[model samples]
Target: MSKTPAFNRRAFLGSAAALGATSVVMPSYAQQIDPYTGQPIVGATAGATPDAGAVQYDTHANQRHNISSFRAQDWRPYFDNLSNGAILCDLTSRAVHYWSEDETVYRLYPSSIPVSEDLTRTGRTEIIKKVEGPSWAPTPDMKKRNPEWPDFVGPGPDNPLGTHALWLSWQYYRIHGTHDTRKIGRKSSNGCIGLYNEHIKELFELSTVGTQVLLI
Candidate 1:
């Protein structure tokens, strides 16, 4: 008769531990959480934040920056219908959510929000205009605060509005792109919601002039 092999309990335990370690060794990005919601962020894209070393400390030295949440959202709680599609800007999350009218498309992007409550506005609005290579002009209030700022900046690298801009019904409010990639996922904008250039380009195409917008 063949000799029975002893059950190697220690070896079995060691193999189990190795398997557990392998399971836990997920990518760093996969383990990210939404700092605001305390929930695991799923399906977030690489564009949600700037690449490593992209964040500029010199420009925002004193500001407290928060990472944007990439968690997907449902539109029902915010909109009655997907009329012309809908866009939701969640200030607390520092993120923007978009849903197409026919429910065929949905996107979530990191955003730059107002630096302070006084500059922020919350309500329903609609995109009244869409401009590519949008020009930039300091609001009267903006000029009052930053006296040395240029009165106007045409569409270019220096333009704060970046490559595309979706003008909203409210004066001086827009959902636009920013050349300063560091601004995304941080509270750094004066009022407008800012997206990475690549992201806003996609969103600009996905949205139209009549797209509904809500900020909260």
Candidate 2:
């Protein structure tokens, strides 16, 4: 009979340690980078959408990520006064910064911006209307682009506008919640700014019509 090989305990333990280290490191790395793009995953929210052309994952992944810029900001640079309150939508950062009239409240939230520069509108605008359980109707241009899209979508899980909407002075423009939370921190909208459903609910309560808005 062949002599039994000596048990290589030291080698076995060394291999086991290395395997454990690999297990621990891989998931942390995976969480940081998007599987599809190999780019760092950035932002506070993520989810799916049913609306046509709503998920532009490839487009967003290819675009330069500005994760560092998504941060808190001062309200003074963009507004004369808090008034009802003030909202700053930073298109480049994909963030929404809010300030209460008395300076007691400040909120910074990740947001979704227009899909392209042509669809984007900068400068100042104001909240003209607020709606809860808001309904959605595709803009004529939206219908023209996707004739298969529904004529209307009532408030629910499928509504692209999510639970609330703060309509802006610019027609067809809104600071709203999106059922597609993944859109937050990405350029995925026709022209509106989108926040997570929960984030928008808090903003809706904290804000009022005439809240100053600036997109830059």
Evaluate all candidate structures by whole-model CA lDDT and list the values in order.
Answer: 0.68, 0.70
Clashes of 1: 0
- Lowest summed lDDT across 10 adjacent residues in model 1 is found at 17-26
lDDT of 2 at 79: 87
Judge candidate 1 against the unseen true structure and give its global Cα lDDT, from 0 to 1. Answer: 0.68
TM-score between candidate 2 and the true structure: 0.74
lDDT (10s digit) by residue, model 2, range 1-216: 899655342443244212311111112343355433455655521232323224333343434435567656888878888899999998887778889999999887767787777778899999999999988887788878756567887887668888989999988888888654446667887788888677799999999988999999
User: In candidate 1, how many Å is residue 28 off?
Assistant: 23
**Candidate 2 worst ten-residue window by lDDT:** 17-26
TM-score of each: 0.70, 0.74
- Per-residue error for 121 in candidate 1, Å, reads 0.1
For model 2, the superposed segments whose C-alpha errors exceed 4 Å read 1-65
Model 1 C-alpha lDDT per residue in residues 58-100, reported as the tens digit of each score = 2433434333234678999999999999999998877788999
Q: Candidate 1 has which clashing residue pairs, if any? A: none
